[model samples]
Target: MKAIVHVGLKPGVLDPQGKAVADTLGRMGYDEVHSARIGKVIELDLEGVAKDKADARVKEMCEKLLANTVIESYRYELVD
Candidate 1:
């Protein structure tokens, strides 16, 4: 099975990196742009794991190590 994770800052959290990008975009003749947010993607390849079991395992991975649950949230998709 293959697992793909998308990690990003949760609402109400300050994102300096995202803010900077937004500011730059506004100054670059793109004033219509209001905001920009940054995120990450992680892909994992696993063997012997059934698709039915991948969601729980992948969620565990995110909560334990893949994502900073304190300030970020994550979602995962599994593919066979």
Candidate 2:
């Protein structure tokens, strides 16, 4: 199984990097972009775990280490 995790700041949290990118885009003539947010992706491979167990393991990973949980939120997908 394969796991894909996405970690991002919660809404209402300030994102300096995102803001910088948005500002730069605006200056570069990207008028369509009004704002921006930044996030991260993590991909993992599992050799022998079942799909159900993999889901729990990935969720635990996110809660314990992959995401801040307080200021950040996370979601994940499992693939064969």
Candidate with the greatest lDDT versus the true structure: 2
Candidate 2 worst ten-residue window by lDDT: 45-54
Question: Top model by TM-score, which number?
Answer: 2
Candidate-wise lDDT, in order: 0.92, 0.95
Cα distance off (Å), candidate 1, residue 25: 1.1
What are the per-residue Cα lDDT tens digits for candidate 1 across 11-73? Answer: 989999999999999889899889988999999998988887888889999999999999999
Per-residue alpha-carbon lDDT of model 2 for 8-78, expressed as tens digits?
Answer: 99999999999999999999999999999999999998899889988998999999999999999999999
Model 1 TM: 0.88
TM-score of 2: 0.91
lDDT of 2 at 69: 98
Clashing pairs in 1: none
